[model samples]
Target: MRTCMTVRHGAERRTLMMTGAKLVLMRHGQSLGNEANLFTGWNDLDLSANGHEEARRAGRLMRHHGFLFDAAHSSMLKRTIHTLHHCLDELDQSWLPEYRSWRLNERHYGALQGLNKDDTIARYGREQVQQWRRSFDVTPPAVKPDSPHHPGNDPRYASIPRCDLPCAESLAMTMKRVLPYWQDMLLPALRQGQSLLVITHGTVMRALIGHLDGLSPEETQTLEIPTGTPLVYEIDKAGAVHRIGYLLPPT
Candidate 1:
């Protein structure tokens, strides 16, 4: 049985009921940076061995749940790209059309990229680092143009207009870019009854989930998304998010 519910989104009131179409959002598996507890941001790093196993397990879990995706989306970063590949391969959906965008990348950690989280906390107080990391609106210090981690120097982002590239971004800023992609690309497909899969970063997933779930800024900051776990959302005909849960049962 499906339960109908109502959710408030700012000025609008929306009713939600169960629909067959689903939106599956998964954070990419642990990257090398993740293993090292570093702020990776836009720095492209390959998945670690454990990360590869995690991706496989995520795929097996989704397959067990009988989830089939019509299309997939991911950031240009290697971790996400490889994770998506491993998942689709397990599901035998490797041929599905995939869309990549810089908008789906992790929140730019700016000057903090490649730095150890503990070291940063030692240098800057824990509260300040937390603000830069989890706060909705507080951006970290900008990465200098010459910094290797700067997005401007990355070939993957070269096609993007210079003015649009960000040196540093808050979770709120990440939403600004992510929401447009959701509205312009993913939303329409969902409205047309497409089951979609999105592989992205932890912070990116947080921002997107925050928007779709209508979470407050403070609540959004507290949300924790684990790597390689599939977060499933069922949307109805009216495009309201009716139900959300993990594809895999909680361990």
Candidate 2:
């Protein structure tokens, strides 16, 4: 089902959308924290060696698909930004215009940013850790704006409206920021016949897919998008969502 469309409401004959604008969602590559199973959230770390390789692989995959996005969007964090850079490098279209916003950042793990996931689970209990990891609203305590871990003072946060910056965010809050960007910036491109690509963090990606697929808050956390993978959404004219899903590779 990853490669093929399953009819949702009607006998909407499915086919590859060749020319219409689309949304291509790509998660950032692995980081040192990811391999260590630490909570990164908005910690703004760089890609590991394997993460760099994953970015290159994504670029190759886009080239294989013959993909072209009119404009791109990414979070302010380095992993997401660098992932976009490497993806664009492989895409061979570095010149294509792009937009960066905080809306696409990974879910903010708050004070848990640098902590080990196993330790958190051990101390807080597995269920509580799971809630912090997946809950739509309850963001864990975060490093303060003055903390070394704070993402607010970073130049990347400059793009974000001040009211939204400096605070840790949950998947729900991410949606609040991202939706406006989509409706304000991205939707116009899609309507005007420009394919779009989104580079972002894990939980943010889930937030968007949740909105696109009509998943409930709890359901989005249950859905998994592998690290450094792509999720493509093909919408048609007349405001119809013809197809929306991930593209799985052969084993």
Candidate 3:
């Protein structure tokens, strides 16, 4: 089941058809746990059937908006890659080239990867879960070094420093991993007027947006950017601040 998406402030603003390319931050389709309300960080779960449909729907939504991504990027995770693939396919640009970087991945939840969000809420209490999910700092207890769940054994992360592997991350800590993409990859494209589409996790996106918008810790806590929504952005050459930030139709 897809969670209801909310595009809070875009409705009041008008979109510009400037010649410069902008970034489209897309949340990946509904995952199995997304329907069930679980924490999916770094678990590498496959997309559920309805999750695939959300990807298809996102593809249609992008095409309908008259936006074409020059190239795309996804997390190494399949949910994001598949979402991007599905969207590109619907755009009839499945053959278009793309890139993948771990910087765009969801915030790692360590030992919490396979846990149920609701049940965790029950055990930890709603406020604690909220803090874990929304709090900028305060990382949850990490997976033990010896646990099989530890990401150190994960082949995909073989190149990453073993010390950083299989650890927990707060939403604030997540930005440290995610922001580099903007610095190293995405920012240059925006400067060159190249349209880009990025499929990433919700908390990661929130961290990115939180950083960009200079959101307060309290404000970050209240912001509920939904999954599977299309966020269209326009930033200046320096990649400094949002010139025009809002969502598109069906927002």
Candidate 4:
């Protein structure tokens, strides 16, 4: 096995390369909700101005490192979609096939959507809010059917079966939906040696990374994926992870 480490500005970074196949997973840039410190959940919001620059920077870094993809994937949400667009445009590969799926959407925060995070922490107590945010299976309080934040009431999900629409979701539940898309869509492409780029939300990326890296539920909770950072995974022909790390130096 070969690995390279570099130090710049007092920070150490690791770069890993695979012999044949690669997978890149990136969390979308900061959203307006993120800027407001609100629980966005399934609410569709655009990226903030800083978020757009972040996406562009991520793209430039990837391109400078010669990262290329045969296809790209993102959630149906506008934030992720815009991030993908900006990244691809920066890479000058906007022609790549782009796949969008609801399975890649952020974890539904139920009635917590649109609420300020600090206020929620104050109202529900910090420990409970943390559990709702990080626990694998501890679902938050479900949004009422009439609640504006309820995904079941969103017209964008109209084509999906009503039973499949989530009013609230735990990380584990989000993984259940994400894995099928990986298995049905991404895995086969990888088997054929196609490099893939996936732009998604933080929790969704965590679910996928945990699944790919064989992490336990507890370990997944401790994992933090920063916005706009690209995680690179090198997989061998046997479908095992050969190496994994961030594509750019940590900011």
Which stretches of model 3 miss by more than 4 angstroms?
Answer: 1-15, 240-246
- Give one digit per residue, the lDDT tens place, for model 3 in 1-251: 11122233545656445445667887888887687777888878767888898788878876766676678988989999989889898888887779987677788887777899989988999998877777788788788887766778777778889975538998777877888888789888877767788899888788778777788866765667666677766656766545354454564
Q: Pick the candidate with the highest TM-score.
A: 4
lDDT of 4 by residue, 1-251 (tens): 23232212115465444456678889999999999999997899999999999999889877777777889999999999999999999899999999999999999999888899999999999999999999999999999988878776778888999789889999999999889998999888887788889999989988988888888999887788888888877766677664467765434
Q: What is residue 147's positional error in candidate 3, in angstroms?
A: 2.3
RMSD of 3: 4.6
For residues 1-251, write the lDDT of model 1, one tens digit per residue.
Answer: 24243433334455455446888899999899999999999999999999999999888777755677889999999999999999998888999999999999999999999999999999999999999999999999999988778888888889999789899999999989889999999888987888999999998898888899889999888888889988778776678875456554323
Cα deviation in Å at residue 209, candidate 1?
1.0
Q: TM-score winner between 3 and 4, please give it.
A: 4
- What is the Cα-based TM-score of model 1? 0.91
State every prediction's TM-score relative to the real structure: 0.91, 0.87, 0.88, 0.92
User: Residue pairs in steric clash, candidate 4?
Assistant: none
- Models sorted by lDDT, best on top: 1, 4, 3, 2
Arrange candidates, best TM-score first: 4, 1, 3, 2
The residue ranges of model 4 lying beyond 4 angstroms of the native Cα positions read 1-12, 249-251
Quote the positional error of residue 183 for candidate 2 in Å.
1.0
> Least lDDT summed over 10 consecutive residues: which range in candidate 2?
1-10
